[model samples]
Target: MKYILGIDGGGSKTTAILADETGKILGKGRGGASNYQTIGLENAGQAIKFAAAAAVEQAAENLSVSWADLEGSVAVVAGLAGADRPQDRERLRAALLAQMPVNPIGLRVEHDALVALAAATGNKPGIILIAGTGSIAFGIDRNGRQVRAGGWGPILGDEGSGYFIGRAALTAVLWEYDGRGKPTSLTKRITSYLQVTQPDEIVPLVYQGPLQRPEIARLAEIVLEEAAGGDEVSCRIIADAADHLVKLISAVLSRLDWCEPGIPAAGTGGLLQPENMLWTNIAKALAGTHPQVVFAPPMLPPELGAVLLGREMLDTAVGQEEFIANLRWSIEETSQS
Candidate 1:
């Protein structure tokens, strides 16, 4: 039985899955962050190997193969965050290959968003809008042409992201303090969130001090709450976030083949909850802009998407239908286990 290794790695965590070419679920494992940009190459490499080893360890318990014998893997697909450029992808490929148990025949490294879109579209033609710690809209047309917008990180881009929503509220709070903006309840709440009595004191904490990107993203929840409670400032910020995200989806859709009528698009990330203000605002806006677009949640998780992509690299490419069905069915068991 030939094995395939599929990895979904990001700044926060890493998940690795072991499956046969037939899509049989063998084992699963997790490790720390593998984003080389944040954790550095050595640490990211170690994290990838650790996750792979743990998966192989579980596979050793369930199958005939052990860690040392994993060289029979047919392919490996690692969909990693921060590995955007081809050079970065090559670097990550090396990182995953070094001191690893498996010596797969085919190895590929892809950006995390691509894997998310694959999961959403089942490798069909579609677009994925991811607004987590960062934001990016990536699409694959029927002809395999790919296009992306946003995802420039906290400073330059990441429009419609948690960090973007969070920063906008905090900035509004400061403006309110200076009497430049309307008085809103977020001033008090955001001040408390920042742990400062006066809103002006947030300057040092935000500019020259702590409040990392993730830390700032936490404030987005507060903004969401305030918007639900009818806070004008918070409501406006949420609307702006929705507008940015809608534009991202529109930008990708316009460049693709189905631009005239519309196409499939899915939402993936923290702020995209169905019950939330952001989701509603974006949905309403899209109803007018692109009526034929069917927006929904991701069809599958990214690791399974990585699995599908790995399956694509096989030589014969037969039994694809069975492979997808079994993979989907096995994911339920894996999740329950």
Candidate 2:
């Protein structure tokens, strides 16, 4: 009863999935933030360990197997946020190995964006644009060349991300409050969302307290709500976000040698919510210039992408069309049941 473990360690949370050799999902677990760059290495390591252990334990109970037995038979692929550099990947891999009980047969750690790409494209050469707490555009060419744009984190980059939209909303509110900009509903919406009577209090709450990146990112929802309610400023912010994301995609495409009309692209992350104005605007914007581009829904969640990649580490044949289809079916069935 060999198993593979897929871990998606993002800024907001860590998710682990346990699956059998045939790619049938066995169990799943979730834990706290595992972005080693944002959270400390120790905290990130603990989150991974907690998620993996919980998944393994759940699988063991269901299979009537022991934890020790499961550990020995596992292979791991982790798609971790903040593992942007080779050294970051190595350090986090070392930390995970030291912290977890599993001595997996094989292990690979990659940037979370790569996993999103894998999930969206089924390991094919395509682009993945993710806009959650942070934003990044990652692509792999048919030649196996990989390029990325805008993953510098919240402080330096993260354009088109939830954080970007939220920060823009905050600034818009402050500008309106100071009579520096046209008054907008964002001032009232943002203040209400923060549960503060005045917009000035948001500055102190952000600077002096537990308001973290994800919390700030969540504010983008308020902006979306206001935009839907016909606020001009909010609509402009959403449009700007879409434009930034389109730039990211265009940047990646420019670096690639392929000029085929139908290059595949996929979107992921909270900011790309299909029902949101941001997502709608992005779709419309892309269709105008990149009409030849084919946009598809993701084939698998990012965690399952880790699983598929882990299996590929052992045997590339696991990525065959039939195998992937079966795997996708199993995952879908599990989700429904």
Candidate 3:
């Protein structure tokens, strides 16, 4: 039987799923960071290989088939971070193929944001605002036109991302420590979170220690928690994050000519949680400006969206109501198990 593999390769982790032609999920696997730009090409390739092999092995086990039997018929679709340029995509594709256990029918690689957008709208024309460890806004119009804004990574952009918020919190803490800014709870909270006795210690920990991007990004949780507790500085940070995200969405919308009423838009990533002030403020801001916009929740995670795209590549139709329902059930079951 023919099989398909879908991969979501990100800065924090890599996820791979194995599914049949009809969109029935069979197995899932996860591994460490795969953003080639952050981790280097060899490391990213290893992560993708590790995750894909695990998924394929698990599917072979479940179906009582030999691994070799499952290999030749599989179609691979990967949505990888840091694959923005055609050369980057080609390099990553070659690296991933080199690590595969068996030759597959075909392989396709795309930027991670495209898959996030696909997952948000099920390949329909809509906008997706993703604010995880990094942030980007991508949209596709009815005419198959695509536009994007603000995925320049931490050093260049990622304005509303976890890294952005965390770096801001750290800056605020440092300012407060030096008496240049008002004393805020973040000064205490950040020092404690970093296990440093004094705020100045953060300098060495960030610069000399093994502090990675995701580690710094994790500090955004502390900012959120403090904001929830009514810390003024933390609240302002989150509000600023919301404003940045709104601007990203608005820019994409303008590029897509989607300023009219009833354009479907959705959000994905850590900051877009409905329970958080970040998301609430973003929703309010967007509504005030674009009242007719329909803000929908994501229909599927990016990994599953990769699978959907893989199916499409195989000339198979997915995203029908029943198929989506089954896919959702399969995802929940796999996640729980």
lDDT of 2 at 123: 82
lDDT of each: 0.85, 0.86, 0.86
Q: Which residue pairs collide in model 1, if any?
A: none
How well is each residue in 242-335 modelled by candidate 1, as lDDT tens digits? 9999999989988887754557888888778775889888878888978988888787776788888888777544476788788888889878
Runs in model 3 deviating more than 4 A are 315-319
Tell me the spans in candidate 1 whose CA falls farther than 4 Å from its real position: 62-65, 260-262, 315-318
lDDT of 3 by residue, 172-220 (tens): 9999989887778998888887889998999998899966778888889
For model 3, the run of ten residues with the poorest summed lDDT? 315-324
Q: Which lDDT tens digits does candidate 2 get at residues 1-337?
A: 6778899999879999888777778778899999999799999999998998888777777775556776678889999999999999999989888877757888899999999898888888899999988899999999999999999988889998999999999999999988987889999877887889988898888899766778989999999999999999999999999999999998998998788788888888887877589888888888998886776667777778898787775544444576578678877876786
Candidates 1 and 3 compared: the better one by lDDT is 3
- 235 in model 3: Cα distance from truth in Å? 0.8
Worst 10 residues of 2 by lDDT: 313-322
The local distance difference test score of model 1 is 0.85
